[model samples]
Target: MSDWPPHPEAAAVPSLSDLLERYATLRDTILSLENEKNELGELIKAALLRGERAETELYRSSVRVQKRLEYPLERFREVFGDAAALEAASIDRKKAEALARAGDLDPERLREIALVKEIQALVLTPKGS
Candidate 1:
């Protein structure tokens, strides 16, 4: 209503220091919330185990209970046989890295075998406190 376009100088620009501070504050808040969420999740699991019903009102909430069977590596191999164990075993990256560094394996081949993804991250260091 007032002006169709605002002046460049009139526009507010956030400084790097301000942005870094905000990022750090947000990271800390997210970590705190995650911890709270994990604690609440455990409580909910307990409630579900105790036969608490899922509610659907202003906020729809449900608890899913699942039973999982975990087998010991050595015992599992003994019970299911070595062929079954070999089939279930995942590729070990550390061993592969060692092999590559020792010149026993090609680095390019190793990279090809593993899922490679490039990520850019912002690193902030605080001034002397």
Candidate 2:
């Protein structure tokens, strides 16, 4: 007898049922962990708001809150003229895409302006449910 156990060919290939079961298990695990994380985040936020800090063997955590100033576009435009508001604002993607489609602008120019990424996902559903 060899030191290593013999591998069965059947064990090498996973069935669709096995894959689906594993997928479901992982999905449930991810959802449960996400819920726990959200709950912890809310607790952290509450503690921080109450001027509390937490120090553990593994980590030290504190919150620093800051104020941000926001300008309402239409109201701002009404107050400061459209040209000035447009100069202050960032590029509008929809208008840029339209211009690119119309050949009024070079698509190559967008390489520096935007970073495009592709995403793929597998969606599983129960039969007739």
Candidate 3:
């Protein structure tokens, strides 16, 4: 084959004006894509910020509900006087003893114990950490 570049017509075909026009068109296309990329980046940033705010709000709401329940739980203990509390304890002891008497363990008592263990796990967790 002959030399690939610098054919005589190659230098003569595109005038300076035509080359400048092509450069301008490519520059405008690049700038438009840049603007679109910037807009998309800004949108992504705003969405991430909003998601963080929503997570914070959800945590705050959960704390509020937990705080609201505290008073009622205390009131329930107060309303059920000491005598009733002792009676309930006695009944529980009797039930436990009865379960021991039986050959098989009480599944209900086991379930209650498991539930209490789970609840205590939640209760002892440090706040805001």
Candidate that would win on lDDT? 2
Residues forming the 10-long window of minimal summed lDDT in candidate 1: 120-129
Error of 1 at 42 (Å): 0.8
Report the candidate with higher lDDT, 1 versus 3. 1
What TM-score does candidate 3 reach? Answer: 0.31
| Residue range 1-129, candidate 1, lDDT tens digits | 633234567676667887787779879999999999878767765665577754433343455434322334465446445664465464345554565577755667555445543332212223331
Q: What are the clashing pairs of model 3?
A: none
The 10-residue segment of model 2 with minimum total lDDT is 118-127
Query: What residue pairs are clashing in model 1?
Result: none
Residue-wise C-alpha lDDT for candidate 2, range 58-119, written one tens digit per residue: 55565545432334556545654666457546435555455557775555654344534332
Model 3 CA RMSD to the hidden true structure, in angstroms:
26.6
Angstrom error at residue 14, model 3: 1.5
Q: Is candidate 2 or candidate 3 better by lDDT?
A: 2
Candidates ranked, most accurate by TM-score first? 2, 1, 3
| TM-score of model 2 (CA atoms) | 0.43
